[model samples]
Target: YRELLLRQRINEAAQAVMVAYAMGGDLDQLAANYNVKRLTVTPADNDAVPPVAAVMESDEALRLRVPAAFEGLSVAGPTAAYEFH
Candidate 1:
């Protein structure tokens, strides 16, 4: 059961990554959450592979074709309500 739970958690994290890939230009919040890290993005800018969240939010055409899950995980910026990112 513990293994199953871990698998589920891993899958959830993967889904989150997919979501981030959708949004365009790699917003800081989405990338951090999906990767389970505090802002460790590579390239400093969009390169061959952009951040998951960045791909989805982007209206502009992306070089790579991201998935629909990207549309779902639109992790908001630091909430003004709680002042948390």
Candidate 2:
């Protein structure tokens, strides 16, 4: 718990530094101008977008042990309660 809190504080501090740098504040000059240590970041080699939709579970992949007639019915209201002739 103690270590997690310390890591969270460090992360928040880094985020603040990033926000300041984004608002036209010089990162390298922060130490000399404001007497603060500038946060350094190295860009990753592969900055590709992740294929999230490809690995998501589809409707067909849902596992239910119910009958076929009760498959897509919603039991929340009286509209689905009527039986078909």
Candidate 3:
């Protein structure tokens, strides 16, 4: 039991260092390091009889965007610069 608990703790710690494999809130935190924020795909509307659910950008999409953001920093106007913005 003690060994299993230690392994679980080690796995949790590894998530912070392994941003590429991170998901959900962990991914969000990692993206913030690159000054990227998750975008909302669908807005929530509570005024309607049935409230609409809000859909956010997926972790996979955000992961791709985060790296692309760095390309925007360059002035050379690479292909990624166009996509980044």
Candidate 4:
């Protein structure tokens, strides 16, 4: 997938999370849709474009770059919910 397309997907995911959060959905439920785990440090990698965070990459490799800009998040939103760790 193209980098622009992947970023779009990541943005979509982030938006969904916000929606779910607004609806008071538990983190697990939202995470489930996003492949997030419980209590574990899940990579917020949103820089998933073209062979980076691809659905085909090995799990370990994807997890390693979770903290990246595209993966983690570079921009702040109107109601930005993410915080630096």
Candidate 5:
């Protein structure tokens, strides 16, 4: 069924996210494991957004904004491949 297939893909995506997260701060490993381009993001040097919100709410991370089903391993915009403080 279409619904079942969709659920399967969602599961895969979630698993991918978990896998990438488990890689710790290693972007190379994340990209190599997921077979996708990897890049890191930080709010602009002068931007006003809180760094925590930037990672927790930005398009890069789906952990907050979208339903668990709709969020894939990656989204349309930047993804936070690493965190620096």
Candidate 6:
């Protein structure tokens, strides 16, 4: 049991470091490297059923956005800049 618990914790820690699997603060930190910040959702005041009170970008979405940000740095072309990375 102890060994299994240790392995689980290790797996969690490992995933936290990877953008493909990281969540919350870990994902936030990774996004920061690209100068990207997660967007927040604003609930409608008059709607009968508003969206979640605190909706933040999902890890999957943020992961996609981080790479796209690299495209913006290009003076020549996105493809060229992207290929440099």
The superposed Cα distance between candidate 2 and the true structure at residue 68, in angstroms, equals 60
CA lDDT of 20 in candidate 2? Answer: 35
Candidate 2: segments with Cα more than 4 A from true spot = 20-85
| lDDT digits (tens) for residues 11-51 of candidate 2 | 76675455232222333333333333322233334445752
**Pairs in clash, predicted candidate 2:** none
Worst 10 residues of 5 by lDDT: 62-71
Cα lDDT tens digits for candidate 1, 49-74: 74444323232222121332244345
Candidate 6 Cα misplacement greater than 4 A, ranges: 43-54, 79-85
lDDT of model 6, residue 5: 100
lDDT per residue for candidate 6 within 1-85, as digits (tens), equals 9999999999999998888888889999988988888876554355447543666767787887777777767888767466534
- Compared with the true structure, all predictions reach lDDT values of 0.40, 0.37, 0.87, 0.43, 0.41, 0.79
10 residues in a row with least lDDT, candidate 2: 58-67
Worst 10 residues of 3 by lDDT: 12-21
> Which is the winner by TM-score between candidate 3 and candidate 5?
3
TM-scores, all models, native as reference: 0.26, 0.24, 0.86, 0.23, 0.25, 0.67
Over 4 Å off in model 4, which ranges? 20-85
Ranking by lDDT: 3, 6, 4, 5, 1, 2
* Model 1 misplaced regions, further than 4 Å: 20-28, 31-85
Error of 2 at 67 (Å): 60
Instruction: List, residue by residue over 1-85, the lDDT tens digit for candidate 3.
Output: 9999999999987986566888898889888888899999988888977888889999889888988878988899898898899
